[model samples]
Target: MRIGFVGGGKVATAFGRYLHAHGLAVSNYYDRHEDKLSHACRLTGAHPCQSAAEVAKMSDMVLITTRDDQIEGVCRDLADHGVIRKDHLVGHMSGAHPSLILHDAARQGAAIFSLHPLQAFAEEEKALADLPGTYFSIEGTDPRLASVEEIMAKTGNRFFRLLPEHKRLYHLSACIFSNYLVTLMACGLEALSHSGIHPEDGFPAMMPLIQGTIDNIARLGPPKSLTGPIARGDVTTIEAHLTAMADPSLASLRQFYAFMGLKTLDLAIEDVLQDPLKANALKKVLEMG
Candidate 1:
């Protein structure tokens, strides 16, 4: 396929480089920032186009790697410019927005798809290396599904299809798994800092435990993998933690802990590790403050 990119950000550069590395034809690219456009084209060996219309004219497939808010605008521009051809395949790489954001292009007779990589891309080089073995969530017309599949296959990745209505929930799950996990770790580091443990020291000390917990989850799955004071129904230990977080300055953290403890209690009961009485006792203690 003759592919083109409309934005020269990390994702655009990463996808372009990966396709080029795999011997696919990445023909042209366009970006508002001249430096970024030049860098992306250099990385992918693609010709630089001065406008989105030029990019559309040079390629059979156009991947819009712009920010989520800008995707529809770019699509509208392509349609208004008469850039999108009936035979063109157009897609955006956003987990939050569904394929419908490309409605302008679709209205102009282009096939529309949403192609989201279920991995974080902090840097282009890392993204290029990590694209393989990644899972993608794709939503599109049936006729263009095979085209998206072929692109994913070339990168050694797998994909599953989702309905447009499910995209928000699907992206929420991804946020909980990837984004919120980082926030959770930040919370842990902050709590440790109160005891004079620097983040540098805390992170190293916590990694093994974190990795072990992840391994347990992988091996046994959620409730079965849960192991902690709450899971053990240790009301006394739970009370101690609550007391430590009771400072007025830590009101939010205290509530956070309590809410999570209540959820953990549910897991304990679901896993058959605690009877109703024990679970109720744990819940009562978590709710105490």
Candidate 2:
């Protein structure tokens, strides 16, 4: 199939190069930025088009690799130029929005879809090589999507369908796991630094424990997977933590700790029988908040 890319930036470069490396025909590419066009053309050895119309007109499939907010505008541009053919397959690579944003392309008689890889692309070479292990959340009802599935499978990536309505929440879950976890780690590093531990020195020490906890979650599931103070129903340990950090500055952290402790206690109560005395102590401390 003759494939073309619009907005040939890092993602376009990565996908185009990876596809061509795996023996797919990446016909041409187009980008508003001359530098991006030059770089992508050099990487994929594909011709660069001077206009979006040119790329859309030449290819059977067109991937809109622009920013999420620009997708609709680009689709409208293709429609205005009468560039998209009735049977052309068009898609974007945005995770936050669904394929419905490409409705203009569909209205132009093109088959539209969204296929987002659940991986960050900081560099083209590394991303192209590692992208195959990435999972894709795809959304659309186009019959030609079968061809997309075949090509994605060639990359050895997993593909799962996501309804348009579920797109935001599905992406939100990914953000919590990937992005928010980074934020969580940042908080941990700050807390360690506040206690006079050098962040660079401390972070590495936590990596193995974090990896082990992740493995436990995978194997045993939550509640059962939880360990440490609250899981053990160590009310004395909890009170000592609350008492040791009773300063006003640590009040917020203490509250957060107690809230999380109460949550874990609930999980333990459901999954593990706890000593009645220790349970009562924890409940009293948590209730003091």
Candidate 3:
């Protein structure tokens, strides 16, 4: 398939290069910025197009890799130029915007979809290297999304489909998994700092435990992987945590602990332990505090 990208930013450049590496036909990239267009072309080895329509006209599948807000505009440009052919695939890489946003492209007989790679695009080279290991979420308005699936299969990446209505749920889950994980890490670092451990030093110190937990989750799944005082139904240890977090300075972290503890308590109850009586007791402690 001849695939073109409508934006020349880091995502487009990285994805274009990754496709080219996988022996796919990568066509032109068009952006309003000449330097960005040139940079993308130089990295991806795709020729630069003069307009979004030009890119669409030359490709069977056009990926609109612009900022989330600019995607609809780019699709409208292609539609206005009458460039998209029947059965052509038009998709965006935005996790936040559903495929429904590309209404203009769909009106022009294109199969509109969002093909979100669930990974952050930080460094272009690293992004390209990480593509094969990433999972993708696809949501589309049309039934002709087999082409999208086929492309993902060709890349040997696992992918799943989401209903357009459920797209926001999927995006929010990703935000929690990736973005909120960082916020949670900061919370941990701050709590450690109260014990006189400098945050910079404490963060690195916690890496092994954090990484080990991640590896455990990956291998044994969340339920079986879980271990801690909550899993053991050690109410006294949790009470000590409550005591430590009672300080005015640690009020937010205290709340954070309770919220997270409640969730973890549920996991513990459902796991092999399956001790709801203990879970109920832990729940009471968290709520009462």
Q: By TM-score, who's the top model here?
A: 1
Candidate with maximal lDDT? 1
* Candidate 2 colliding pairs: none
Question: Candidate 3: lDDT of 145?
Answer: 92
180 Cα displacement, candidate 3 (Å): 1.4
Question: What tens digits encode model 2's per-residue C-alpha lDDT throughout 51-86?
Answer: 888998889988999887888899899988888788
User: Residue 175 error for model 2, in Å?
Assistant: 0.3
Clashing pairs in 3: none
- Angstrom error of the Cα, residue 22, model 3: value is 1.5
Model 2 TM-score is 0.90
> Candidate 2: lDDT of 161?
88
Which should have the higher lDDT, number 1 or number 3? 1
Give the runs in model 2 whose Cα sits over 4 Å from its true position: 262-270, 273-289
Candidate 3 lDDT tens digits, 80-131: 8888888799999999989998898888788989999999998988988899
RMSD of each: 1.3, 2.3, 1.8
Superposed by TM-score, candidate 2 places the C-alpha of residue 135 at a distance from the truth, in angstroms, of: 1.1
RMSD of 1: 1.3
Steric overlap count per candidate: 0, 0, 0
Among all windows of 10 consecutive residues in model 1, the one with the lowest summed lDDT is 272-281
Ranking by lDDT: 1, 3, 2
